[model samples]
Target: MTQGGEAAQHARDEGDDGDDAPATLPELYAAHRLGLVRLALLLVDDLETAQDVVQDAFAGLHARSRRLLPDPDRALAYLRVSVVNASRSALRRRRTARGYVPPHEPPGDSPEARAVLAEEHREVLDAVRALAPRQREVLVLRYWSGLDEAGIAETLGISRGAVKSTASRALDAVEKALEAKR
Candidate 1:
């Protein structure tokens, strides 16, 4: 162990490094998780990515700590740094993976992208994701895939009339969802 590590070990062995600090992993996680996630969210701009960054930060600390952090408060500082670095890495990965589109996302072809950039497409994307699975499947197949009702029915294993109804209903639901958001 390094000199700092030896000192931290000695502090832990002596117990009570003062101020009623958390000495265990669970306690540390409980104390700092919310703040860490918020920090990550500010950097990453998405709750899921922020949560992932925090989790990864904790996991990295765990990997090195050998099941017990020698100094939990110092470990929290380490975790804050790790979360920041991990969020940067996440943004870089997202930038490099520009081709990846999540399911149910309407394609952002240049013209449509420009059109919706004026109107906030997040509402539409959220509406699509909120759709029922069958409805979503029908809508994507019919519109994005440029399939006819019969083709969508064939693909989704439903009757043509069912496909027509599902698509109509899905479109109505998406409209309602967007309207509600507005």
Candidate 2:
């Protein structure tokens, strides 16, 4: 097997075996890693810590890859939850570590995709970063990840009503924030 294949197999062996093996970390990472990293940046408000949060979240996901939710939407919800939780953990750890503050460096566009994603992508990224963490998470999951409110609630471990209220508050906050900048 290839190196990636071997790594995936190793990841699987460490997870529960009763369930059909879920998609490999490399596979999931290849598909969603960048987006998740970007989302983490918005949540944690620090580039390096955001990247670390994404990595840690992916590691947790890999450890439980075998027991993923059967529904793809639900699986995505699980991933979002993992990201939020991991980001929070990182934030807490950083707080305890004296004098550690994350730098506010925007992620660079991929050289290959830069020509395609240029200004529009940057605008969206900026908008997302300006949002409060709850709003940002709701926006990223709802719009970016294509998850419904229920899925978002399940992922975030909140009630659907909380999801709706938080998302509404988030939208209002983003709108007002953007309006004030105009």
Candidate 3:
């Protein structure tokens, strides 16, 4: 299976269990924060930035009135959008900094983390990271986050048609890149 397939399953597993609907902010955060962090991690390729992105997303939600976000699904969607945008901003800053630490730190920055992702998975991840930003974001959202086109469109603030086209192109690009490695 592909790395994205495993991530999709992982995300599904992280979702709220049935009959235990999140009714409060803390409950909602507990139910979905990790998934959001994983999403950001895929985009930014940095755990520290991913965590900060998630925390900042939650902070934004916390700053708003509860009345503004009463539904768990709505709250989750908001968080997804926030994470995506924040992840983009982090990427931009990283690029602007130029001389900063490179994305390709040779092997096992953390063996515990490396042990979790196989060499094949790491190869797939590096390929994904090499993609254009929008393509990478669409692929991660569609496959890793297990989000449908509408969800991606909403999260990205783009038209549904754009989401459909972007995901199609992104998938083809990923397929070509992976195949080229064969």
Candidate 4:
């Protein structure tokens, strides 16, 4: 067997064989790693940090598999929550560190530079970044991650009503920010 297959078998061996138990971490990682990383990127903005956040999420899931593995859906939910929380923690640490550090200059591009995103896409991303953290999370989870209000509420540990209101307010804020930039 391949290394990943061996790891999956080991993970399965360590966990209970209950009917509700979710797929092994290696299986989930193989299937959803890219999507989880993309989710982290939307939350954290930096590719490296996003990858770390997804890795941390899977590590957290593996650590808690005894409890979380009971229900596959719940395990997936736990992973999503873990990723969001890890991303938040990373962002918080970054903000704290940035306070003590001086800003650096951007890297100079060479002649082989690729094309930048369209202005509209840049504006949308900028507006998303400008939102408050909770508002941003609501928007990204709802729109980008394609979670419904209840799913977002569960992921965010907020009420469904709060998810709706936050999403509404976030959309308004994004629209206003984009308009101001025009």
TM-scores of all predicted structures: 0.45, 0.38, 0.43, 0.43
Which residue pairs show collisions in model 1? none
Give the alpha carbon lDDT tens digit for every residue of 125-165 in model 1: 78988999999999889778999988998898899999988
**lDDT per residue as tens, model 2, 1-182:** 99988878886687744444345667567777788888889888998888888887777766777676344345566778888888888778777886766798888768867865675566557777888787789889998899999999999898999889988887777666656656
Error of 2 at 99 (Å): 7.6
- Model 1 worst lDDT window (10 residues): 64-73
Model 1 residue 130 CA deviation (Å) reads 64
Model 4: residue 76 alpha-carbon error in angstroms: 0.6
Between candidates 1 and 2, which one is better according to lDDT? 1
Clashing pairs in 2: none
The candidate, 2 or 4, that scores higher on lDDT is 4
How much does candidate 4 score in TM-score?
0.43
lDDT of each residue in 77-141, candidate 4, tens digit only: 98899999999999999989888766797987654453343567888999999999999999999
Query: Residue 50 of model 4: what lDDT?
Result: 98
**Off by more than 4 A, model 2:** 1-23, 98-182
TM-score of 2: 0.38
Better of 2 and 3 by TM-score: 3
